[model samples]
Structures are given as structure tokens and as C-alpha cells.
Target: MNPHNARIEHHPVLGTLPPRKTIRFRFDEMIYEAKEGETVAAALLANGVRTLRLQEEKGTPRGFYCNIGHCFECRVTVNGKQGTRACLTLVEDMMEVISGKPFSSPLKKGGNHA
Candidate 1:
């Protein structure tokens, strides 16, 4: 599927939507287009990007389970800020989002527990 044309033009509840302002943002170093009012998760999902991040220890792939802010499964890095929830954050033009980075535990193995 073409990522550029991956938006839902019509909704069953909302009906046809008027054209929204298009903005550009970067995800994992790739540029993508999103509507002005779209959230980071919405924009990424519309572009066919399902895998948002990797599990901290297992490295398992993770995506948006609960679209609402309740579940933090959609957390990602935005503009150098770590642990930013994509589902709640709005997408801004020229915004940079990074995901799927290798996990590094704060406490080292056999380290002292102060």
C-alpha cells in the first residue's frame, strides 16, 4: 500500500471530511505527510506504520494497543524527548520522531542497589 495515500478520506460517523492542511514530519529518519490536526499515532498509522517501538528487554515489536492516553504502548521519542506518547501528542510540521531503539536498562547487572 502506498503510504502517501493511506489516509481515510471518509468516515462512517463523520462522513466526508474537508481537506486539511498538510504538514511534513520525520519518523525514523523518513519524511511523511500528515493533516494539521492529526496526532503522531494517527499520522503514523495512516502512513502504514504499525510498529511504533520495541519492547525494552525482549526487543519485541510494539504498536498502539489502546489509542487513548491510558495505555502507553504507543510511546516514542519526539524531538529528543524520550517516552513521549504518540497517541496523545499532535504532529507538528518538521517534527522528528524516533522509535525502535535498542533498550538500555538503567541498572546494570550485579550493580549496587543504593
Candidate 2:
């Protein structure tokens, strides 16, 4: 994230930004919360979740790099939907999500697969 990307400010000329609302959902056995109007990536980020799916061969941890969903870095399963871009999908309360791969962060840290 960059300051150029988003700024936390409010001015008289600029309308005040509303606070992000929150929702709850389950990914695997874990129950996590998400913000209303926030993408799955944002919600996951808020909940200390940083992995989406593997990058095919050699499984790697891929999270959100581009929030706009063009990069396809945050694809995951949403309630049985496969290859759904987490960055593009907004979270719904009690929604189900699953990464294409499980526990690939270790691989990412190891950098065994690029």
C-alpha cells in the first residue's frame, strides 16, 4: 500500500469519508471478520490473513498486490466458487471462502518456488 494510493484525510472541500463497516465470514475452520464494502483481500488483511492461493507449480503464497483485481493475485474460492478474485469479491457475513491451496505461506517465505 502507498500513500499515493490512498490518503486518510478529510477536508471541508472534500466530503468526509465514512468508516468501514464490518462483517463476519468463515474460511476453513476459522471464522474471520470483514468490513462492509471491502474486498476479500481487505477483509483478510484486517484479520491478519495474507495468503490467497498458490501459483500453480511449486505452490506459493499469493496475496493482494493490486487491489483493483487486475493482477489476479488474490484469487480464492468463495462458497464453492473457484478462482474468485478475493480482491474483487466483497465479504458477506457468514460467507465461505477457501484458498485454492492450503498453508502455502511457508513456501512463500522459503522462496523455493518462484
The candidate that achieves the highest TM-score relative to the unseen native structure = 1
Q: Each candidate's TM vs. the true structure? A: 0.85, 0.69
Error of 1 at 112 (Å): 16
Per-residue lDDT over 1-114 for candidate 1, one digit per residue giving the tens place of the 0 to 100 score: 344567888999999999899999999989998899999999999988999999997689999999999988998999999999999999999999999665787867788969
Q: Ten consecutive residues with minimal summed lDDT in candidate 2?
A: 1-10
Question: Against the true structure, whose lDDT is highest?
Answer: 1
lDDT of 1: 0.91
Candidate 1: the clashing residue pairs are none
What TM-score should be assigned to candidate 1? Answer: 0.85
Query: What is the C-alpha local distance difference test score of each model?
Result: 0.91, 0.74
Mark the 10 consecutive residues where model 1 has the least summed lDDT. Answer: 1-10
